[model samples]
Target: MGRKKIELKKIECPKEKSSKYSKRKKGLLKKAEEMAVLCDSDIILLVFSPTSKPNLFYPHSRPLGRILERLSNMSEYEREERRSYTKKV
Candidate 1:
């Protein structure tokens, strides 16, 4: 038999929700680190839980400020070129 599918809704049980969050958050950060290393690229992930707690993940070599600065310095033309190239591939 196939695995059961869960309904797309908020988990009502506090214990179940916390357990799910802990497991999934770890998985998400691990994948981000793997991708950054494998692709030789910068990656940042920011997540907020229902109670306003924040989580952040990024490549160890670069700081979040540097990434934000790099993005902020891009010109409109450069951004457009990048977007076009991504669409073509």
Candidate 2:
């Protein structure tokens, strides 16, 4: 048995939109946590709802900004080069 499929478009009803967002957000965070634990990774996940509510998850040992700062160290050109290389493979 498989789950029912829903269209990829935006949900038209406000209540349904909010409900779906809440469910998906929790699921995403849960998966990220599982990945971090199983892989022994440092993860930082952040989600902002359409209503501007912020939800975040990260390793307890480090501040979130430090992880973001590591990403910032890569120049835009360097990032683009890596992206293009991956596409070729």
Candidate 3:
């Protein structure tokens, strides 16, 4: 069950923003854990709050740095390919 849709803009009230952040953060982490358990796969979730605080979760027994590096390299390669294709066209 999800909450009703709301605008993405910042909440003016500090208390309300804090409450919302806590709830959503917990919900996301729970979902991540559930997916990892159900699929038997590696899952890394990194979230940054408005205050720049980071929350990291690793469901599998893998190093966080290694996974981030691999994902970064993959995205870079894809970006380069896309650039080359656009230049040729």
Candidate 4:
């Protein structure tokens, strides 16, 4: 069976909101790891918690510093062009 669909609305209860966020964050991290592995693609995912703590994920085989350096060397236009190319593919 496919995954259940969650309603796209704010959870009104603070307890529920915190619980849901914890669950979803872990799920997202797992998916990011899988995508990096199965696709043999570079991925950099950075998420900030409600309290502003950062969580970073990238393939352990490739260093995050190298990816950041490569990304920094690209111009703004180049970044957008690459995004469009990937979207099309």
- As for candidate 4, its clashing pairs are none
Instruction: Name the best candidate (by TM-score).
Output: 4
Per-model TM-score, in order, reads 0.72, 0.68, 0.60, 0.78
Question: Model 1, 1-89: lDDT tens per residue?
Answer: 99899788889898898888999899999999999988988888999875669988888888889988998799999999999999999
In model 3, which regions exceed 4 Å deviation?
A: 1-9, 69-75, 78-89
Predicted structure 1: lDDT: 0.88
Total clashing pairs in model 4: 0
Q: List runs of model 2 lying over 4 Å from the truth.
A: 61-66, 72-78, 81-89
lDDT of 3: 0.83
Task: Please report, in order, the local distance difference test score of every candidate based on alpha carbons.
Answer: 0.88, 0.85, 0.83, 0.89
Instruction: Report the lDDT of model 1 for residue 4.
Output: 100
lDDT for 87 in candidate 1 is 100
Which of the predicted structures, 1 or 3, would earn the higher TM-score when compared with the native? 1
Cα RMSD of predicted structure 1: 3.7
lDDT of 2 at 69: 89
